[model samples]
Each structure stands twice: as C-alpha cells, then as structure tokens.
Target: MDSPWMKRSRRALELRDGFPRLMAVLNKRKNFQTIPSEVSSST
Candidate 1:
C-alpha cells in the first residue's frame, strides 16, 4: 500500500510533468483560433 505522503508526491509529479503538455495544447488551440481570424480579416 502506498503512503499518503507518497501519493501526494506522485500527484505533484504528475501535475509537473503534465503542465507543459497542457500549456502546449492550449497554445496550439489559441493559434488555431487566431490564424483563421487573421486570414479572414486580411482577405
């Protein structure tokens, strides 16, 4: 069985590893949204 401290540490590690991936996905979505709008406005 895992200790509570171990569980908390593991959870923290998971969040740390996942944070960049989450940021990258959010950035990609933002770019996807802006690119089309910019193109439409220019043309």
Candidate 2:
C-alpha cells in the first residue's frame, strides 16, 4: 500500500504541474471575452 504522506505529496505535485495549464486557459478565455466587448463597443 502507498504511504499516507506519499499520497498527499503526489496530490500537491499534480496541482503544481496543472496550475500553469489552468492559468493559461483562464487567460485565453479572458482575452477572448475582452476582444469581443471592445470590438462591439467601438463599432
């Protein structure tokens, strides 16, 4: 069986690895939203 500490450490590592990917997705979504709004208001 895996140790308890090992499980927690693995979870933390996974989050750390995924955080940048998550941030990038979020940033792209925000930019996509902003561009549409700016174009609509400027027209």
Candidate 3:
C-alpha cells in the first residue's frame, strides 16, 4: 500500500491543479472503493 502522506499529496495536487495532470493522479485509484464512515461507526 502507498503511504498516506503520498496519497494526500497527490490528491492535494490534483485538486489544486486541473485537467490531464489531475486525471493522471486520479487514475491511480480508478478501481478503488470507499467504505462509508457511517458503516464503520455502526460496526
């Protein structure tokens, strides 16, 4: 797994910038799924 810091940095850059660069950064997690925080709290 990639470091949390690295992911945060890449996400920040993507949000700050735009277009092709953001697309490249975002593409890294194209297949990822986010478990909802509500579900975690319920568990």
Q: Estimate each model's TM-score.
A: 0.52, 0.49, 0.38
Top candidate (TM-score): 1
RMSD of each: 12.1, 12.0, 10.4
Q: Per-model C-alpha lDDT, please?
A: 0.70, 0.69, 0.60
Query: Which is the better candidate, 1 or 2, if ranked by lDDT?
Result: 1
Total backbone collisions, model 1: 0
25 Cα displacement, candidate 1 (Å):
3.5
Worst lDDT 10-window in candidate 2 = 34-43
List the candidate 2 regions with Cα displacement exceeding 4 Å: 26-43
Global CA lDDT computed for model 2: 0.69
Pairs in clash, predicted candidate 1: none
Question: How good is model 2 by TM-score?
Answer: 0.49
Clashes of each: 0, 0, 0
Instruction: Note the residue pairs that clash in candidate 2.
Output: none
Q: How should the candidates be ordered by lDDT, best one leading?
A: 1, 2, 3
Q: In model 1, where is the ten-residue run with the lowest total lDDT?
A: 34-43
**Ranking of all candidate structures by their TM-score, best first:** 1, 2, 3
TM-score of model number 3: 0.38
